[model samples]
Target: MRSLLLALVFALVAPALPAAAGQTLTIAKARALPLGSVVTVGGTVTTPSGAFESSFFDKGFGLQDGTAGIYVSAADDVHATPGRRASVTGTLKDSFGLLILVPTDVSLGRQGLPVFPRWTTTAGVSESTEGRLVLVAGRVTKAPASDLPYGYKFWINDGTGEVQIFVNTQTGIDVSRYHLGQALLVTGFSGQFDTSYEVLPRSPHDILG
Candidate 1:
């Protein structure tokens, strides 16, 4: 809702580096992309999306291009706000089945526009919705709980199925204020831990009541 200007630097632009060989970089391409492929993708930062430097988790921010969203790990001091457009050139990585980008270079770009979340069900998220931003409309029927050293994990049942929502302490989210079984609309990047699928919210707005 605030004036969006949160796009970080574009890590794909380098005068010395050669252009993309054959990789067509885009969020949609990454969805079913082959492992180890090097490419460049650009998109807008969604709500709660920005640099999240933390010791426990990878430091970066969430990005979306209307088609989908994914996490981008940048160096410390790289700050981008929500709605900032960013482009990154890197290799695709599957960290225990969770996909991400290992960027090489970085540069800032024009601020991106705001992007609304894509409403999806728990089942939809569980099936094949990793590495993207989505909206889960459901109720926080229970108090938020911690998932050990990983992060603070919560539960929300959309009547379709139950799903885990993870938020790190450094993500700027205060889970203590949330009520149990309260109607909420959560926005976050879909991720996974081992075999279970989860959503990693960027900030408090990701778990709105």
Candidate 2:
């Protein structure tokens, strides 16, 4: 009887114990972290909203610390609840301003759901026009009223990569649903507007999922 009681007590107590700390590190671990290494870290996410949550930015965190905290955009559906705990995973790429972790995944811990900013207002368009293949996120500006009607054009700016996104109408994308400020992510051919280039959209969907 005593053996059974002890077994029951152990079973009850084991689960209550705190979870073993996973392989985790701080932003300072960037230099030592190897490429393609999966890691977990905790940090404070700054967001448009005033709230903050204990969050996890994973995988690429180690790579970005050397350069700077990863440059994440609100347009990439990566906005986390302010002060919320989260876990993220992605490839680490070094960029000019900050080390960038091209996040593959992000999860908010016990914190409630996050509220993302809506892409509203036409002034969100950015002026940076460099010829390079890249990803941009921003609000859609008004379509040109002029007669040049080959491809659909809209402006996207995510404070990092900003450009005019031209999607071929042949893809059957409905332009009417795109409001002035609807958040959008544009992944396609990127180059200087004056330079010879092409913009091919991966999909026609709302910026916020």
lDDT of each: 0.68, 0.40
lDDT of candidate model 2 versus the reference: 0.40
Q: Model 1, which residues run further than 4 Å from truth?
A: 1-24, 47-56
lDDT of 2 by residue, 39-91 (tens): 55444432322111111112111112212233332224444543455555554
lDDT of 1 at 55: 24
Q: Per-residue lDDT for 82 in model 1?
A: 75
After best superposition, candidate 1 residue 135: deviation in angstroms? 1.2
Where model 2 places Cα greater than 4 Å from the true spot, the runs are 1-133, 143-148, 160-162, 192-199, 202-209
The TM-score, computed over Cα atoms with residue i paired to residue i, of candidate 1 is 0.78
TM-score of 2: 0.31
Candidate 2 C-alpha error for residue 192, in Å: 4.2
